[model samples]
Target: MTMTVRDLRPEVRADVEGFARVRRLALPFYLVTADSLAYDATHAHPDSHYRPLVAEADGEVIGTAQVGLVHDSPDPGQGYLNVYVHPEHTGRGAGSGLVRAAEEYLAAKGATRLYAWVLDRPGDRAFAERHGYRASRSAHFLRLDLAGGELPPLQDPPPGVELRPGTDFADDPRPFFELDSETMSDEPSDIDYEFTDYEAWLESTWKHPLFSPELTTIALVDGRPAAFSAARTDGGTRYGTVMTGTARDFRGRGLAKLAKNDSLHRARAAGLTEAFTGNDAGNGPMIAINKWFGYEICATEMRYVRELG
Candidate 1:
């Protein structure tokens, strides 16, 4: 009945595997894999002070915490620590221990405000409330059946608009970075984020292990990056659209939908079976687009916040 919390050791295969397993059981709507777990441990932004943790009982990893600062936010002192305990391991002290450890870690790193995502369930909500966390914003995890559901038939882009794979920009992703930065600046969110550093984006996102250049689709307007659908996969059947957005000038032109549909078609043709994505609960436009694509709301999670004293 002994329990303790420690830093996640990504180099240790068992540790990453156990962490991935726990996440899959607790949050199946999103993508999680051993390779992703290990990659983040090594490639996360250094300034974020990322310190993933795990709570172990009897030498078995039962809970995990993804702790880090809001490195991209212009406002400093913002941090996040998302904790999850294995579904079967709940009721033990693992969840609480991990939360305590995560809070202390972020505080030491100068985090004054903290955010965490808790699933929208009675027990999960109650757990956050007990920890002094206040529910703020909510988001939905959606799933589409790439193997069976009828995806929208691909459509030809309008005059001056062309659809292309992300691989076209493999030689130089600065254009994509510029477009992403613009769309990201105004996405529905509780915190303000600015992707000012191109190098940081290259390290943290463009070259991420799960990003699939071949499956990602971009909508170009007269050879300029206008909208894009970023896809990530585990080199398997499970695919996820991490981001789909149109530049400010093209927001109402249906480019996001065009790019996203192209990506979905590519994923299905590539043998991907399931597609997943998430949208802020208040983001009606994006939610509508997902619904149009036959994505069902698989789960919902609320953003829980607490100010550190």
Candidate 2:
């Protein structure tokens, strides 16, 4: 079987569909659609140097790679290549071929440090180690059976606070952006990210194909955006919360929880039966909140880093 790696051709519907299929098989927790795949390929920031690669074996895509520089990171020369091979095609050299192509591409573009997320399974960890990558922080993918599980009953907002759908800020999302920027700054991450480009955020995040403004919930304190739970959907029944955070001044008031609960209920009512989310292992507060909402640890991934000359 001849296997080759090449850049994903978004024009070819089959290529995009194959890439999404491979990703879904490898990372079931993620919601991947052909439209989202094409959007990333076409709309990525120029500074990101993003390239989506696919490994094809006899006209079938068996693996995929999302490779790019971290344009938002304060540190330069940092890049990432997240490669995933279909479970049924694991031993066909697809994973290695995709990684090699990604590494060569990023290296030529002046990337000196590379990072990847490998599943917490032993084989996946060994694969990264064999490639000279060392494990760093870990994160977990959590799942909540919205259809069968009992969610915490919704309650009226506390005095001076109101719950609103993210769509309420459609006319002027700047307030939400301000809240997002502040919360993101405090997020636990290996790289420090600064969100100073409002237009960029609007183009990339606000207009993203997967972002669901109607399902997203926001908490307001006397009309001031205090916390939010951002929701994303694949145009299907699957729903996920990509981010849930509270403003610095609004912490410890359970506003974050309030927003997330509202969002979850909205998602369930919208016919989404499964809910997915991710959390850094060190994010104790968010993890506890997820647990309280009946989310269980479904899968784990370890961050791996490698350096290049």
Candidate 3:
């Protein structure tokens, strides 16, 4: 069993599909597709130096790593690598090989701190500890049975609020951009990100193929975007809310909940059978909201951090 690590060839359909396959097998609750992988490989911000890597044995991709610098953070030298090996091929050295390759690449690129997301299982935690990575914050992957679950009935917007699909702002998405930028700053994470580049956002997010404007919902207050639920689909029955947040000024008006519920209904109407979302473990408010919608925590991932000496 000779395992080797190399850069993912975006041009090769097999490589792309194999990487996506490994990810799907390793992290079954999340939404991932070949098209999304290909898009990120090319459209990521240049400063991030994003590289999709694969560990192959006998001409098959057995493991994958998404390695890149945290370019949006104000601080430099912060890198991240999320490595996942196919469950059937776990003991064949694919995971270790991919991790070593990722660390070397990030170190040479001047990264001082590296973070990785490891599942909360005992074996996964032990693996991270063995590699000198210490546990940090954690997050949970949640799922709702969009097809069988009964969602709360839709209600007309309160006096000053209106619900709009993301498509409504197609002519001018700057409002969406502004709302996203503001909400992201409030998100809980180890790294504080600042979204200052509208051009980059437009290129990587607005134009991405998997982003479904029709399924996304925005809550408007007095004609101003207050909160939004951004959706991503795998061009299948799987649908995920990648971001759902309320503007700082709009917090606690039930706008975020309103937006997400509307988005879920829209996804259901669009024939998406499953709804997925992620929440920081410490985010009790958001977790309560998700629970209210019948979303159950499907899986948990622990964030592990290591300092490169």
Candidate 4:
């Protein structure tokens, strides 16, 4: 049996479904769907040269890789290739082939530094190291039983602040976009990102298939968005918090906590049973907040970096 790596054909539903299946099997903590896969492939910035590659064995996609440059980052030459192979296909050379093809593609596009997330398993770590990648920072995948766990009682907003759903801003979401951009600028990461592209954000985030605007909670200060907890659902009982943050000026006022609590309560009321989220290992404030909400660390993955000459 031979495995060959090739560009993913988004037009082919089977290819996208197979790629998403491998990702779901390898990383169950995160959300992945056919629509999301196609969106990422189609809506990616052209400057990034984003390419989703799949390893095919006997006409079946056994492994997948999302390869692209960090176009939104302030720094250049940074690229990423997140590779996932079906657990059943692990012993084969599919994973290696996918990574090699991804690296070559990014290198040809002028990427000097590459990063990938490797699950914190021994074999996964060893594979990354064998390819000259060194582990940098780590992050955890957290899960909460929204249906059974006890969540903090929802609280009314303080004076001058009011809680609203993301859908409330449907007529004009620029305010939320501004708030998101400000909060995201401070997120900890190896790559520096600037969310100055509002149009792109609208198409990619606000209009995403999984984004649950009705379930997302937003805190408004004098009718302006000050903090928010974005929610995404898989059109089923599974829900996830994609982002929860407060504006810089609104920090320390517990607005973020207030927003998240409201969102979670709404999720439970809407019949969602499971909730998931992720946090960088060093983000103490968010970690503390999640822990306070009874979310348990389910799994961890390490970010590995490699340099190409």
Candidate 5:
């Protein structure tokens, strides 16, 4: 059977469902849905040149790839392509075909460096090595059973601080955005990013389909957002913390931990059973916070980099 790859058709329900289905099966720790897939396809920045590709075999989408440039990074020519093949559909050449198509697309767009995340399994690592990619950093996918596990009891805010839901800032999220930008700058990563576009943040993050403002917890200092835990739900029993961070000035006060704990409690109270999150290996502080919440590492993925010629 010949494997063919093409751009994902967001308008087609089957295409979106197929892409989401494969990704869910391949990466169970992630929260993916048809609506999220469609939203990403439509709202991606033009400069990023985002493209979702599907490898089809016998009229079935057996693998998927998300290809794009690191548009928000200070450096140019850095690109990313994360490929996921249906576990049952591996060894059918779909993976290779998808990678080749993605690489060609990025290379043509003037990308000089490429990054991909491969599950830290033997076969996956070997595939990356065969493709001239070398492993760099690693990250862990963590899970917590919110329904039955014992969570740390929610505590009252300190004398000067207050805990509020993200919804409280619905009228004006600029403070939250500023706090997000500050914390994001401190995150450990291979790419350095600066969040300067408020409109893009509103469209891509604030209005995202999975974002649950009611469950997200924010820490306030003098009526300003000082720390926050952003929550995302799969519109079901699965909930995840998309981001948990504190402004640099408030870093040592444990405000981030407090915010995330409060958000998790709210999520569990609302009937979310499974909680998921990811952290870079080098993010010791964030990793320690998650550990305090009883989250265990469920899986790991390695970031692989290749210099395009």
Candidate 6:
């Protein structure tokens, strides 16, 4: 009847699978798999000090945590620890144990501030507050039925614009990196990130296990990348758009909408059944865009911050 938390061993298939299972049960909005988990554990930047942990009760995994430092942020000594306990196994000390272990690991690495995402529910919020964390911004997880619901009709690109899949840049993905960095910098966030290292981006984002270049749609204006909708698949029927944005000069032209629509259409044609995406609560434009595509808000999570002592 005792629950204990330990570091997740990426080499062990069962350990990685268990961790992914717990996360999927707790947060269905995210796409997690054993391969993705193992890739992250092995390919993480050394400076970030990434570590995955699992909470076991009677030799069964019931909780998981992804703990790491935000090394890419301009600010120093900031870290993150997102913990999730399986819904069926709550109130068994797994959640608290995972958080405590994650905090201890982060604090030992000189982290001065820690951030976490908690489900927007009374009990979840109470747990964070009791652990000395204060709620900050919020984000919504949206779901679209690719198999059963109607999608926005695909529209042809206007004059001087062309639509292409992300695979077009298979020889080189620098353009997509530039586009991603520009749009990501403008996103409303508590931490400002600088995506200056192209090599790092290539190693982390472009080559990720879940990245689906063929399914990602890009809008080009005069042969220049103007807008893009990046897609990631769970190696199953679930497809998620990780990022979709238009270049600064291309905003308000409906190019982003066009790109996302094309991507969704492609995903559905490829046999994907569900589509998922997330938007910050304060991002009115993106939220409105997603709503226009028939996406519904399925869940919300509030960001929590705590100062390490």
Q: In candidate 3, what are the lDDT values of residues 1-309, reduced to their tens digit?
A: 778899999889999999999999999898888888998898999999999999999999999999999999999999999999999998778888888999999999999999999999998999899998999999999999999999998988899999999999999999999999999888889998999899999987899988999989999999999999999999989999999999999898889899999999988998999999999999888999999999999999999999999
My TM-score estimates for the predictions, one after another, are: 0.99, 0.99, 0.99, 0.98, 0.99, 0.98
lDDT of 6 by residue, 168-260 (tens): 999989999999999998998888898888888887889999999999998999999999999999999999999999999989999999999
Give the total clashing residue pairs for model 1: 0
Ten contiguous residues minimizing lDDT sum, candidate 2: 196-205
Model 6 residue 183 CA deviation (Å) reads 0.7
**Positional deviation of residue 114's Cα in model 6 after best superposition, in angstroms:** 0.7
Can you write out model 2's per-residue Cα lDDT over 1-309, one digit (the tens) per residue? Answer: 899999999989999999999889889999889999998899998999999999999999999999999998788999999999989989778888888899999999999999999999999999999888999999999999999999999999999999999899999999999999899889898878888889878878899999999999999999899999999999988999999999999999999999999999989999999999999999999999999999999999999999996
Over all chains combined, what TM-score does candidate 6 have? Answer: 0.98
RMSD of each: 0.8, 0.8, 0.7, 0.9, 0.7, 0.9
Pairs with backbone N, CA or C atoms under 3 Å apart (clashes), candidate 1: none
lDDT of each: 0.94, 0.94, 0.93, 0.93, 0.94, 0.94
Q: After superposition, how far is residue 145 of candidate 3 from its true place, in Å?
A: 0.2
lDDT of 1: 0.94
Model 1 ranges with Cα > 4 A deviation: none
Cα lDDT for residue 168, candidate 4: 92
How good is model 4 by TM-score?
A: 0.98
lDDT by residue (156-270, candidate 1, tens digit) is 8999999999899999999999998999898888899988999989987889889998999989999999999999998879999999999988879999999999999989989
Q: Model 6 misses residue 284 by how many Å? A: 0.5
Give the runs in model 3 whose Cα sits over 4 Å from its true position.
none
Runs of candidate 5 with Cα error greater than 4 angstroms are: none
Q: Can you tell me which runs of candidate 2 are displaced by over 4 Å?
A: none
